[model samples]
Target: MVARDAQDNVSPRSSTTTVTTGAACGNPVCGVRQVTTDTDIPWGLVTLPDGSVLYNRRDAHDIIQLNPTTGVKTNLGTVPNVQSTDGEGGLLGLAISASFSSDRWLYIMHTSPSDNRVVRIRLENGRLNTASEQVLVSGIRRNKYHDGGRLRFGPDGKLYASTGDAQNGAYAQDRSALEGKVLRLNPDGTVPSDNPFGNYVWSYGHRNPQGLTFDSQGRLWEQEFGNSIMDETNLITRGGNYGWPACEGTSGTCGTAGFIAPVRTYPTAEGSCSGITIVRDALYVACARGARMYRAAISGSSLTNVQTYFSGTYGRLRTVEPAPDGGLWLTTTNQGDKDSTPNNSNERVLHVTLGN
Candidate 1:
């Protein structure tokens, strides 16, 4: 599976053969070994056109380039300073420029020195032009947790971001609050005129939505963290409200707020949702408490047949990114909490291109 040149220092090379169920003697999903590591507690991953993998390390607040093929690492440097925070602080999510073919920008969603902001930087030869970094959007609430800070470009070229409720459960329902909502912004970081709220929000009523992405058909979806029980997976739309502190699951109408219910949800003790990815026709979500991979098939507007796997082996699945070879790149989060030595056997990056 040859990939397009990774414009600039980015390229997605077809480094290995597809991992089928019975092909390799010992390994299947993860064919290549991890070459270099950031060791700052890696979070999300994005593969460049040249097969180079870009990842973010939280405690250090740095973005660095990793080459699974050669085991070489080049630091992209610390993200812009973030204010003091706990549980959900420092640097978080990342998004490669969809217009990288021309713009050459790499965007990051992090809690900045002032507030939570999405900033853009240039990656030259696998290094960030940190000095030129600038905030794309600002004034987002920062807190101990629920600072929903995930960013991704929709297939429509609009930037979709998820922000946590900053532990303030009610903010998830406040249309005026930027926290606890999924926002749609133009590439320049302005509220999209066609945005559902006619302002900065695209969808509201979310607790701590960490994962946001689009399926092949260009429909956007998100995975939300439930307070005690009932985590969720939702298909996003204009003006949609995903009941958070207001409603727990797909049970009620979310108090006539016209809530858009999740396609699937489960008890948090069994399934605390984290990262989410749509591969092929299936949606894959990472679980913290469940410590497994939740798989479901997308049927038009919703998801069904939800199942969980990968329990116990990997402590917790953090993020899943679309790969160039039709596979998905998975990241671990036991270290994401910023404590304990990384369990190498479980804390490695994996590429899974599935087949029978």
Candidate 2:
């Protein structure tokens, strides 16, 4: 089920030899088709200007390039000093520079021996220059689980990173700590001059924020995992504190704690959301336990006309990336989930075409 990376590291499992196509269920706006059946726990995906796809496998700890048209996957190289431990810590999010074509700079968030960190590397001529790795940010604590690792570049050209509380609730409330916070940094790893905290910390009091994206208006949106009661989709604001342990969803003493409430909340059973992407004015959220994609109309910070797509059709959806052709590329995490079995075709990236 698992393929090997260029370094011979075990890649993710693929589903079948042939591509599988499926009709849109309930929602008539989009149809889905399996694009590549050759990925194992693909965590992050970013498309290049030339339509090439660069992705990362969580356990594999390597960056891979996939030819969108040919289905050819090339392992660029393994990121140095990555500790892919059990649970959620490992090589996670990947983001290319705004000037990737010229600078060839790429960034990744991963777990190190001590804590989770963000590192910048050079991608030269289709290969990753591992020796060029520069640790941009470090000292964020990590645990066997709850290492929130999602990286994205905001429209302002600043690097935005999400970090989990590492199961330490107090960290979410600690203004001096990096864990359980959203950070804003320059591409070179320095704190932005206008950061609200005078440091990298932007928003705080987040539990496990896995999804981050910018709307057309440049406002940042986040999707987070809740403890047991609820899951959340939030509008991230500068210096906004989202009540984490002090607040489960909208409950608890969040209002008194000056915590920002979520735009929408779902019961944990209905949503263990992971990745998110904005397309055609709708925010598409990928769910793991819910096994569905939730599309909501975005209006400022509020979500309306919330609709569900592919409910239970795909198991444990992970990354939902916008494709070059105005569609979406969705990766599933069924290989090791309790609801599904691992197969050669289990973990797959699906192309989704939205209708009018």
Candidate 3:
């Protein structure tokens, strides 16, 4: 199969093999290869139109461009005013504008001195133009931890952002507050008129949702970090309320009493999944504490055939995205994870090829 993107650039031919029921290779993931090592918690991954990857170094506050084929890297410069909370804060998510080829806009979600915010900067001539920084959203509460930060462009050509409750669960239920909610906005930093609350919020009642992606059907899917008992993967709906403090997973009265239950839930120990992306007909999530990758077949509005892979093979997976070559690009956050011993070898970006 080959893909001709919006720019009319044709990708190389790619194919996947499906094994029969009695085949020795039961797992769809057939190969794994290390692409880059010694990254400082590569938190965000995005494949550019030119097929080069742009990723963020969480604590470093720098964006680096990597040529996937040549193994060469170039520093795209640091984002100014980005400060780390010494925990989960700093430069967190990266996304390209829909009209990137013309607009040259690159969006980022990061922690500032006072709060967590989303900003867009110019990526011109292979360098980040810090002077072109424009704040798209701000005033989000930020703490030492739980600063939910992930940015993605939905199929509707709107900017969507996931924000954490900032360690305060009460914020999750507050529609007036920007924390603990997913927000929708116009490309120019204004709230869309069609936004459910007449504000930037698209959905409410979320703890620390860190992952956002759209499926082939243009439906938005989210992955959230739970307080203690359960982590959730939700099918986002307009004006929908996902029980955060009131209900977690299916534990409380979710899917009833005006609350929406998660399509799937996992024990926190087994799935603090973060980055999510759909490749082909499957949804893939990268786990942190779980040290694994999750693959689930998307069946209509539900996810089926849930399977976990690479448990403990990678210290802690942080981000996963569709590769330009029709595979997967996964990043590890083992550097700062409390469970793992600090080691240079632990942090890496890996390429994984899967079969049908």
Top model number, lDDT: 3
lDDT of 1 at 290: 79
Candidate 1, which segments miss by more than 4 Å at Cα? 1-38, 251-257, 336-346
TM-score of 1: 0.87
In order, what lDDT does every prediction score?
A: 0.75, 0.86, 0.88
lDDT against true structure, model 2: 0.86
The positional error of residue 329 in candidate 3, measured at the CA in angstroms, is: 0.6
- TM-score of candidate 2 to 2 decimals: 0.89
Q: Using TM-score, give the best candidate's number.
A: 3
Give lDDT: candidate 1, residue 58.
Answer: 63
lDDT of 2 by residue, 315-345 (tens): 8898898997788999998765331111223
Clashes of each: 15, 8, 0
Pairs of residues at least 3 apart in sequence or in different chains that clash in candidate 2: 12-40, 14-344, 14-345, 15-344, 15-345, 15-346, 16-345, 29-355
Sorting all predicted structures by lDDT, with the top scorer first, yields 3, 2, 1
Mind giving the per-residue lDDT tens digits that candidate 3 earns over 133-213? 999999999988888889899988999999999989899888899998999998889999999888999998998998998
